[model samples]
Target: MIKRIAYLTSPGPTDRRGVAPGIVTPGFQMEFVQIGTPTLVNDPADLMITDLAYVEAAMRAQRQGFDGIVIGAVADYGLCTIRASVDIPVFGCGQAGLLTAAGIGDKFGIVTIWPETTAFTYDRILRDNPVGRQCVSVRYVSTVAEQAEIADEDGFYQQMQAGREGMMLRILAEIEAAVAEGAQSIVLGCNCMSPVASILAARSSVPVIDPTAAGYRSLESMLLLGLTHAKDPRLPAVSERGPAFAEAVAAVVGTLDEPEECPVCVLDEYGNASCEAPSHEAAPTSADGTAQ
Candidate 1:
């Protein structure tokens, strides 16, 4: 039987969602979930909001009968929380790439786009550390301005084609720098860079891990083995915390304690609580400072 996989993208629908259809493997029916709005994950605070949303999506995915979950982003947003919340295996592209690379070679490095994304990719590598050793190096191949030109779905694909030889050369140069530092394998750190993995691998002597493909294969293997995350340390037993308490925790973590009826609630520009109503409002203030 074909496995049903929830492949969650870190960016909002407009950015990279269109490319998800091309990334799935043969034996899996993939359902893609976007994390949040494009502006929602621009910074660390926003990343936390996106992560919270991801956990909610994961719970829904489990109830909806997905056999496994895959996070397409390199940072692996909400990866652990979702794994703990559900019995199904959850794969993060960052971890997937690192583990796959480790099995193929001694040391690995990641090549990503833009400085912000470079930091995101490197931090995940540091956190996952699947190889048991630090990566040889982490490098960025594009500047913020350059990435801006190709941030859209069509532009991304257009830039990955042979017409953009200059961009490909820059990426190869960064990978070469990692090789100079003794990296024996390469992990394509951005999902948008998946299109070039084969090209990069063919040009080099070491294995090149395509982050999304690694994630899909890893999740597929786990499902075939009937293996989920470990129950002891990786996912401890759940406490008796009920729905009310869970909502409270979510409110605190997501900074979403504002009154739902308030119009401003729709505007969470910085992923924080929406603006409070005027003190003179007819609605009484709830104990939580929200209008009731």
Candidate 2:
């Protein structure tokens, strides 16, 4: 069963809601870890960078003997790759909240932080799932610029509390609007909104699900049941040394303009990356040795 759960917040390490003081439970515990990379994620390019950070963070948690990893975002940024890479169960707030909403309500709506992330909610959480049909609308509390400013600031937690009362009322309005639009339930689309989750849930008549909490509980329950995502048929792994592998190693750990080769990325008996001597590049030698 899960004794420790790591909640990974994306693209940065500024959030302190669940970290500084931390949260406690009877049977297990949750530790919040910042991705500690590109400070914020506003678009697909940002997500590309943050995705790698999140996967690495999850792996680190697994290495530390954590039983489960809960990605603290409604986007579920690296959900697929993380699950494929780790042995423990991986939960994303987006999937967790959406699934929960589907189970309890005939129809639901999503109130996320802002516009750019709203796109992610539609693309990742709603677009493909049958539950998408039940998600009537995905609304936002503010503009992308507003969220970006807060995310970029050093005092993120303080900024989030700047107009706490106003933010709550705005979120409450969104929930009421969703209910008017035939929503039987609502899911807060961003996991970072945990600070105000209780206020939103209390003021709103229909259920206002806190995605972070949903994901946390989901992982905890899965652990108790001895369950996790299917990893059979094994996920993709790099078997050859190439530009692709070299680029990752460079970006993450070094400054290689273009390494000729990278250590062969092979999965050891435990599904861990075990490298051997290099020289696996696919560049072909010409018939004339120097020319084609």
Candidate 3:
């Protein structure tokens, strides 16, 4: 049977609007989804939006009947939350990138885009993977000015057309530096770097891993192995917290229709008969030991 997966991109809709999905390996069908709007230019604000959007998407993934979900960003926003919300496989690009590089060779380095995102990508990789210590360093491919230029559609394609000799030269330089730093392999730490990964691979003798491809392949492996993320401290199962869980979902995703009044009669935690307010602290948490 063909496995269906949802690939959720952390960027706003218009960032990669014209870019079409690449050819996927057989036996898997991927549907791409984006979180946030095109106007969210600031990295910090964009990340916050991506996180909330990721949570919303994660909630619907199971209901949508997807076999798994792959987070497209190297930062892997809302990865844990999504894993906890669904029984199917959940893949994070950052984790996959590092793990793939680790298996291929020891002492890998990351080549990411944008200086502002360097620290965030590094931190996420370390937090998600125990073998992250093998990652020696991270380097940038472009500055803010270059990034701004690439925002123009013509400029972006022009760079890609230039191949390794043109736009990819700086990134190649950084990858070489990693090799000097004892890095046996290199991981492309940004989803945006997918287009240039092959170029880097051809230019460098060592292995170069693309985070998005690594993440998707990781999902495929997990499915083939009949494995999913563990439901424990990393991704605890959700517990019903009175009507709040339903109510919150309803408020955001409209999972439930608003009651005309309070049709359903339910007793409060304090033995009070009303839905107006929690009669007491309500145990300070839910049955799953999570805060209500």
Candidate 1 segments exceeding 4 Å error:
10-27, 130-132, 147-158, 161-163, 233-292
Displacement of residue 51 (Cα, Å) in model 2 is: 1.4
Off by over 4 Å in 2: 11-16, 19-24, 116-118, 144-163, 234-292
Model 1 lDDT tens row, 1-292 = 7889887753322232313565556777877754332213334554565566667667667767888888766677767777677777888777888887888877888776544433643575566665737588778765544433332433422464332776677778888889899988888766656656678878765677878788877887888788887765644444232353346434644553333222111112222323332221432221100000
Q: lDDT: which candidate is best? A: 2
Tens digits of per-residue lDDT, candidate 2, 1-292, equal: 4398887863222332342233445778887665534222334544565567667777677777888888876767668878877788888777888899999889999886554344643565586466778898887766534533332333222233443676677778888999999998898866556667777788888988877678788887898899988775664531222334335634753332343211111112232222212222332110000000
Q: On a 0 to 100 scale, what is the lDDT of residue 134 in model 2?
A: 88
On the 0 to 100 scale, the lDDT of residue 257 in model 3 is 32
Higher-TM-score candidate of 1 and 2: 2
Candidate 2, clashing residue pairs? none
Clashing pairs in 3: none
Best by TM-score: 2
Residue-pair clashes, model 3: 0
